[model samples]
Target: MSVPAADRGATTVAERAVRRIAERAATEALPPGEVLAARGAAAVRGRRARVSVAVTLPYPTVLDDAGERVRSHVADRTAGLTGLVVPSARVRVRALRVREPKQGAEAAAPVARAGRGRSGAGRPWSQRRVPAAVSAFGCAAVCGAFLYDVVRVHAVGRPPARWRARLMEWLVTHGPDSGVWPGLVSAGAVFLLGVWLLVLALTPGRRRLLPMAAPAEGVRAVLDRRAVSALLRDAVAEVPGITRVRVRVGRRGARVRARLGFGGLESARRAVTEACEEALGACGLARPSRLRARVRTDPLWRAPTPPGANTGSGPAGSPASPSPTPDATTATTATTATTATTATTQGSSRA
Candidate 1:
């Protein structure tokens, strides 16, 4: 007999208690003390001395409740056939929910803002200041070490004052004698300028760098693994409509490769391209030569159209009729003029 939902123990405390008792009894009948937990187990007595057990469930897909129930029921029934006296019980449920979907979503939502504030607002400022400080400290340390090395060289190995005089004489003779000191100073200046340029070239930009290419070409950039992963996290969080984003960032150029998922291929491509750029830019990466964003459409994300939708009623077709094309409008005007002339001729003929 079909159990009406209203009569199936939801309406009254007495009925619910009875159902709960029957559920526990039926559950106990099938291999008790096994430490299996039921999310929402209930029981009811059936006619012909049988009990019914139903449970809402949760877990790995391999441990799906439906398959488990089927296997357990079969084993118990087989045992009954072997005279194991498996109680004439039934376990029936339309659906099993291991855990409710809505329960923990709220708890997770606030974490995003907290994380953003910590990293975006707080960490970046610290990162910017700390790196500059470290660089400045490094420069000072280098200068101090160089001065110490010069002093050590002077203290440890001084050829007689005669050697110094000979070296000076060689410079006076072979080098630009009049401007030798200035030339030496200029060379040192050039060396320092080259070192400065090299350092500037190596440092990352203050803004995030996204090196994305057109969809037709693939994206390539050298990036830190952590920076790319952070970008991917942000893309996943901020874009609600996107279904999936796959990001790969390489070292050196911060080369970015991404596969984005959306309801449609076009939208997916667009989102991936935009997200890749934003992520790279945020990390202060320069665009790479091979930056590309590939967009993939997920079959599951296809939007369902209302049944019996009119496909032809888009921009091309309208209930009000198409506006006349330039040629068509000219032809129409010519036809009207011809008709007017014909009417005048007819009137003249009648006269």
Candidate 2:
């Protein structure tokens, strides 16, 4: 005889299956052409599930609206497919893509703007993974220790935990009327620590990584300051008169110092400055750098004229003549050089 349906075992849905359902739902919520990919994870306990979905979206779209659409769709679809109550659906927009405008239709393309007041230019923060993991671990350890201590003291008929015993003794002995200075000092230290944590939580921490413009709206773009410095070095090296190049990149701007090989001091300085600016611009930084761009020249050690170019170096056009020696005083005045050494910095700020 066959068993009745009532006596049969309950059906179960695997967590992976729930996750796939959520991912499918999230993908379906957006236009097929626009979405690059979608992924999801689900946690199930008893008959309830919590889902999180990650998706790529177009730039300039209202993040809130896009997120909500994905969230609602995932919740409804998961619940309907598995009969599992979905209490929460988290949607993360991984990136924003800027669609290229069709040729000859550039005028019709819409400008991408950062939503709200946020500079769509990304703030590369150290996600606080360490702090969060430490916090969670701390909480778990404390709770477990407390539970173990309780069990040993009550059920097992063992002495209380030493740590707990000491803590209790301290609390019992230290009444409300403790030393004012000690309590006040401790309170002040705690307050300062809390304020410091709050500051870290609210501020973006990766100062060295600068925001850059991406092809897509609010597109995530970043360039390292050290990398920028290297590029500046290469750019200055390319200029004809520069023998040695040094570059320093900071938050405000980049400072470049180039040594002249044979060209006019003023001309070499100008060329170095131009190279620095051009290279910096090409780096595509969203904001300007923090340091100023500067160039310093040492005319005392002009490189020996190349044998090939020296054919006419003798008095300006004699074949096989001696090269005219470089005179520091004959070049631009030190006053002029000093005046032109510093280049004003502008515009490297966080988005």
TM-score of each: 0.23, 0.48
Q: Candidates' lDDT values, in order? A: 0.50, 0.75
Cα lDDT, model 1, residue 14: 38
When summed lDDT is taken over every stretch of 10 residues in candidate 1, the lowest stretch is: 117-126
The residue-level lDDT of candidate 1 at 135 comes to: 69
Query: Distance (Å) between predicted and true CA of 158, model 2?
Result: 3.5
How far does residue 220 in candidate 1 sit from its true spot (Å)? 24
lDDT of 1 by residue, 232-276 (tens): 656744654565455555543333343333344565556666766
Candidate 2: which stretches are off by over 4 Å?
1-100, 103-118, 124-126, 168-193, 302-351
What are the RMSD figures for all models against the true structure? Answer: 20.9, 22.6
For candidate 2, the TM-score is: 0.48
